[model samples]
Target chain A: MALVDDNLTAAGVAMEGEVSDYLALLKPRVMSLVVFTAAAGLLVAPGPIHPFVAAIAILCIAVGAGASGALNMWYDADIDAIMSRTRNRPIPSGRLDRQTALMFGLVLSVFSVALLGLAANWFAAGLLAFTIFFYAVIYTMWLKRATPQNIVIGGAAGAFPPMVGWAAVTGNISLDSVVLFLIIFLWTPPHFWALALYKQSDYAAAGIPMMPNVAGERSTRNQILVYAILLSLASLLPLATGLTGWVYAVPAIGLGLVFSGLAFKLWRAPAEQMKRNARELFTFSLLYLFALFLALVADVGIARFLEMIS
Target chain B: MTAPTEPEMLSKEDSDKLAKSRRGRSIALALVLGALAIVFYALTIVKMGPGVFNRPL
Candidate 1:
């Protein structure tokens, strides 16, 4: 019995160091968001792409996003090991070695960018390469430890995917894609500040200069409110530009209001309920972005259906 | 000269486990390399298009 128990424990420990460990290095949740937004951009663009080509482009974008995630994990492993929220990440948990993760990330980055250039166009591929560099080098290595404005600037990396998708289809960016980018860029600060409000100690412990840590909670809350109001207006730009119609506008306005309302509530919450309020705002922010994007896609789909019937 | 020193022996279960792990790693590496080869080959086909065989001498 003792021998079997010992073997079982050994097996369990060994199982932790598997292919899944390497996959976890990719940060799959973030990759999913990138994929969804990229696909929406592709679908809404004013060009026809073969389904196979579309699939290949989206795959390359997802792989490129994954590559950036892996590189970030490789670079941030030390701080990840220190933070309670991130201590169980692949590198921090000792499931994957740092050198192996670094090499894996580098190889994936090259492969993803090259494949995207072949599958789509050089413009989209260039954007992917730049996004990876911006996230792994600019954000993770420099701004993360240096300034409270890290999220505001680092948000550019995440906001580039839809534009890349647009370029993949159109071979150029237009005002429509820029509006998509701006919506995400404006939305990022408040979304991240809400989480930072609740995870203040984790950021402090990790030596990261997240807004709530460098600035007081009052300042952070005020900034979140300000960004929320800006984001609410920015979300309506697609409607104003006629890229999307009322189908998208109604939800954009409604969800934007809800998001701003949550931010205001968080700003006004008592000290005792601050954590709960921040968490609520963080959760709602995710829904707000997703619903906004989905509304755009739906508006396009509905217009196409009507045209076909007419 | 003395006989060559015998190699350290592993227990039967330990040796079996080691063999399995090595096999798994080998297969994984081979799959990755094979996939890379296929992707590069596809890119070549896309780049050359249908004109590769029809080019003039």
Candidate 2:
């Protein structure tokens, strides 16, 4: 019995985190969005790539994105602990230690970049490496704390995945990929600002300098409306560039109108209704981006089907 | 140098939970490694083609 007690005590000293806790460090929801947009970029790019290579490229990209998330969680664990929304994260909740998270992220980042270079082209690998660095070092450590424009610039990190995906296939950047990057880049401000509007207290408490915390809510609302209009216009560029046809154009126009309308509503919302309006815009913004990307992919698929039949 | 502190004792339930967690991590690690091996193997076949088998010994 004494030996059993001693062994249990030894086990207790070393807190082994569950696999799910480690996965939580990866921010799976964000990873899903990264994967979807990256896959869209890969599929929509005009090229013949080995399906196997395509799968490997996407896997590497997902792992790299998840690696960045882990690094972000490790660095932001302090502010994360202060915010109710992030208080339950692995590090903040003490399910995993920060050092472990850092090491996990570093290892995965190296592996993902190296393997992508081997499986795909070096250009795509370089983009992935830059993306990880941008998110982990630039956005998380620097921009996030220092400036109100954090999300505006940090949004570039998230915007790179699809471009990376396109590069994986074409081995070069093109106007179409740039247009895809622009759509996400412009969409990010309004999307994140709306969330900040409702969660102003969280950012204030965490000293995050989010737009709504740094700028007044009214200023943030106006900026969100402007960005929403810009994003809508940018979303139609695929059609203008002849990268996509009417299949993409029709949905793009409709989605852009709805997105801008929500932003307009939020801008004019009464103080009492501000949070609800912001939340509605935030929720719809996600659907809007997802639908827009889905439409792009669907347009490509339909075009391919028509070409094959003809 | 600081003296080593005694380890804290855990209840049987906590010990069991830790053991389960450790096992789960091991399984996940194994699956990831397996998937990686498959990826490399497929990549080799795709890149090298029948030439993979024809390499000089």
Candidate 3:
């Protein structure tokens, strides 16, 4: 009887992971942003791609981003359990076990990369694979715990999707794609530092060494302002490179000013009001990136339409 | 050391829930596989064009 009971348990007769639990592991909110940005990259590229191929590239990028999220969740489950913001994630919440999450992430990562190679060019596929590795191994395992500059460098993983999308269409990186990469890369520091400001206690408890907890809030706020200024300037590179016209340029400049303005307010905010200001900046940063990318796509579409009519 | 004890068995309700979860996962997996097949078939058709069917054996 004991032997039979052990066999059933070994066969996962007690497994309780639901579909939603698996989905939550993917960090769908982040995946949505990745999908939007990747699609923007694909749409704004110089040459045309079959609609079907473009769809596949976007799907692969989304899945690859989700896979990395799962792997991050698996590795960070311990810290996640300690941090209030992450305490309810699948692994930390006990909705799914670590091994199950790890296996799921690995399987999805492999399938997404392989399918992307088969569907798109291998260069794009290679970029997807590197993005996954950088997120799972470098950011999650090493830099996240090792440095206060975690998100500063770890931001590269999140920034790669748009470049991968561009490569999927062009089969090579270009100055335009690099500009897109720079925009997000610069945006990450201010964006995450804002969140870190409000969630300082959580990182402290988790021993994660986020910028706000490691550097004083004053210093962190200073850094955020600097990055915001740099991001504002980088957002205009599309115009300099002729990738976008005043349509994108106007909105990019407007959004960047607002982003910088918020960061400036957050910097000068009194200690008593710091958290509120940080929260405000964090919320607007999301809209800023989304709007900036949307403006780029619209600008490119308008340009192409006018050329076609002429 | 004492002999190892028998593993605890799940209650009927818990067993039913587990079974349902497993079924849901299976269905999700099946749908994903089906979608993959459609993507591959469409890609092959798009890449090769109508001439794909006329290729010499």
Candidate 4:
């Protein structure tokens, strides 16, 4: 009877691992943010990129993001199976073999970068290639399991799409493009640290050295507030630098305030407040960045079109 | 979805099926990638110069 029971449990575990592996492929949340940010950058860049190129650029960015996700999954499969939150991932669940994921990631990484370059310019393609390397090699393989500051430096990989988009159109980078990159770079720590605070146990169980896992919740909360304030300041840079007008400025200031407000609330709340507040901050932080980027796109689109005619 | 009940990787016939599935996926992947590249090249590079789409309409 014990033998049968053991066999059943083993089979059940295998099935769960399989499903999580596929979910790891989709990397749905990451894809959502990448697509939107890349599209906004393309729309607002100084020149007209064919709509088709714009679509492809976004697709390539998404594929690159997925590639990074797959690589992360492949590397972290062992730990993922240990954590409750990640146990359902494909590799962890044993639905998809790690070898299959590694092949998929490599193919997508090569395909997306090579194709982006051919479609746009070597520069954009190069950026995509570097992004894949940054996330998969530097961030995933090196940083993520090593240090608490992993997301801070690693976040730049996520921040590259807008620059890639600008390069797609302009064939060069600009200060405005850099500003977009900065916005995301600064925003990432607070956004992720919130999740870290809420999911420290998952990180602890997985043996991943996420900041909150290494630092106690008190220290992590302090870090979130500090980063949040820094992010708010960075968010306002578009106006101070004159990269954007009040069309972007007004909302940037307003949204920055609310984002900071939430961060502080998260900081001050009791340990129990950590989960709910962190989730709220995570969800709202996404909206904040999206709105900011959309505002910039709208301003640039309207203003540039007016210039072309007048 | 339930994976196959077989514990072994594949018998000769099953290997054939696996090969076909993989080939199908690869071909489909190639076609999709090709189509996507074509679309991007047309928009990003071909129609990408100054005033390329600046018509007043």
Candidate 5:
């Protein structure tokens, strides 16, 4: 029976081809956000890292994120192959094989963790390792398929980059780090849910019960509005805690307002108009988070410059 | 850049894709080794004290 199950599994697996297939396993776009957020953590932290070391830390973050993406791809390939939106991904598109993605993820995971440990303190290195585990094992293998609450709980994995970034620089977590963490954590649901709204059938057809597909679109949009309000309120924490200046403040407020407005628009949308609003909100939320973090980096940079000139 | 002369000669172009695939692993190896060398030089040879990780702002 066991051998038969193994044979069945092997037979069920899809074969993929091409070099870009392997590259696609890395989810480069999501890795970019991870790299940027982690870089901001390092840049804004209260200490100095040698330029080269800082770059290495960022590289380690990129690699770890890439590894997580690969692991996610490896596990999700089954469902991903079913979803129209995701069917072109490496494993699903028959460009890269599943076992190859598995090996690639494992190799990159070990290399990233070991190199981060050697390049920086064990504190930062350990956090990176844990992040890989959380995303790959906890979220991907466990929560995502098991629960509609998956993203809400598993969002912590995505939110950890800035904290890892802070640790890379300071080797400790702070209120500011927590604030940054909270911002991303709160932001995740609204960001992902909007996509879920637009991609409901893809998710439903894939047998992944995304909230919009399971609970209904109205409920999903309402949740998006709630998370957006909570996210907007959460954005104010960084400024309130003194981690950001007006550079981050003005734009955060502006961005948060627009984000909330979009959520409101999404909430009030007619059924015909709902998916369009969700798509726009989904796209803009990514930009909103990137801009918020960039603004933080700039504010801190300018503050440091002023301090030096004075 | 320039107003696009896009796809003026699609069929005649060099198959750089072939060379890129053939050379990709070597290029990646070189980058990795070079990075390792820089890390080694920075940490061991130059003897710069561990750079300040973070100082309270």
Candidate 6:
């Protein structure tokens, strides 16, 4: 991982002097979802964490995610340049050098993991370390270029943040945390496959074998529908297991139905209408995830309010 | 280790950019070190409990 200075200099000076380029390397939009879900995990865990400590834990998670993003950009620069959606990324656009990104990611990864261990527990820190490794190496380096199930398996990296957050407070994993993990893990394929359906040509051009590129669109749609049904069931597990109250149960079940319905609609869409269906499913998938996690947080808040009133 | 002093080969603009970058790096390093110090302090306080930093006087 020690990228040589000469190799970086060959890419020439940065095209832009703005710090936003560095921030862009972090994939902040994705990081926001990681932070939000991690916060929900931290909140709904059994024990209390000092607010300051909770802040630090979230910060560490966010930084770890950013580290993963930078490393991914560094490694995927070649394919990124070929894909229109990613061509203007900091590295491929020449706003930042690959070596600089490599160093930035490495330094942040070490700092976040170490700081989390100090602030929380070794288990949480270890989970975070694994997450960074999984995204940067397991997913970006290997699976992305290798198989159609790349996102399916690699989704675990995104799923781990909530578990890490839960562990930060509990110092151990539990069934509840696993449920949270399962929700995101199962949600990943359908969410990404919808985007993949519309962006199939981009992946083909980049030589990346996303599901829509490798599998026929019909097969991919069928698989997505199956995952969507499974995801709906997983989303309701929290309430079924009595981990959360009705505040979460009602919306969780409702969103799950809507999510599955969208998937079914996409599956039934004609070839000419597939892209439009995919875009609709993709848009709703984001809302589906945010709403599910928000329900979890809202349940805790409502319980606290009732406790105070009584 | 200490950072190298002004280099011989860089143009004025490049030198300015290098200086600016060094300054930014230094400030960031200081902030991180400062935050770590506070976190360690907070952890110590938590470990020691309420009265550790307090005095009747």
Assess every candidate by TM-score. Answer: 0.87, 0.95, 0.96, 0.82, 0.86, 0.88
> Taking chain A of candidate 2, what TM-score results?
0.96
Query: For residues A1-310, what per-residue lDDT tens digits would candidate 1 score against the true structure?
Result: 3553444443344433566677788889999999999999898988787666778789889988998899999899899999998899988888777787888899989988988888889999999899999999999999989999999999989999999999999999899999999999998999899999989999998889999888899999999999999999999899888888999989988998999999999989999999999999999988888889999999998998898899
Q: True-contact fraction for model 5?
A: 0.04
| TM-score between candidate 4 and the true structure | 0.82
For residues B1-57, what per-residue lDDT tens digits would candidate 3 score against the true structure?
Answer: 999875666777767777788899999999999998999999999888877899678
The CA lDDT at A158 in model 2 is 93
Q: Which model is ahead, 3 or 4, in terms of lDDT?
A: 3
Give the range of the ten consecutive residues with the poorest summed lDDT in model 3 chain A: A6-15
Worst 10 residues of 1 chain A by lDDT: A7-16
| Global fold similarity of model 1 (TM-score) | 0.87
Weakest 10 consecutive residues of candidate 6 chain A by summed lDDT: A4-13
Position B31, candidate 6: lDDT: 84
Please identify model 5 stretches exceeding 4 Å from their true place.
A1-19, B1-23, B45-57
- Tens digit of per-residue lDDT, candidate 3, span A1-310: 5564453453365345899999999999999999999999999998978999999999999999999999999899999999999998887877788998899999999999998898889999999999999999999999999999999899999999999999999999999999999999999999999999999999999999999888899999999999999999999999999999999988998999999999999999999999999999999999999999999999999999999999
Residue A309, model 3: Cα distance from true site in angstroms: 0.3
Q: Write down the lDDT of every candidate, Cα atoms only.
A: 0.87, 0.93, 0.93, 0.80, 0.85, 0.89
Which stretches of model 2 miss by more than 4 angstroms?
A1-14, B1-5
Best by DockQ: 2
Which residue pairs come into collision in candidate 1? none
Per-residue lDDT for A1-310 in model 6, tens only? 2443332242234542346677898999999999999999999888878887888999999999999999999999999999999999988988788888999899999999998998889999999999999999999999999999999999999999999999999999999999999999999999999999999999999999898888799999999999999999999899877788999989988998999999999999999999999999999999999999999999988888798899
Tens digits of lDDT, candidate 4, A48-151:
66666677777888888888889888888888899888887777766777787888799889988887887677888888889889988999899988899999
Model 4 lDDT, residue A108, Cα = 89
Residues forming the 10-long window of minimal summed lDDT in candidate 5 chain A: A4-13
Which residue ranges in model 1 land beyond 4 Å of their true spot?
Answer: A1-16, B1-57
Q: Candidate 4 DockQ score?
A: 0.11
Candidate 4 local Cα displacement, residue A63, angstroms: 1.4
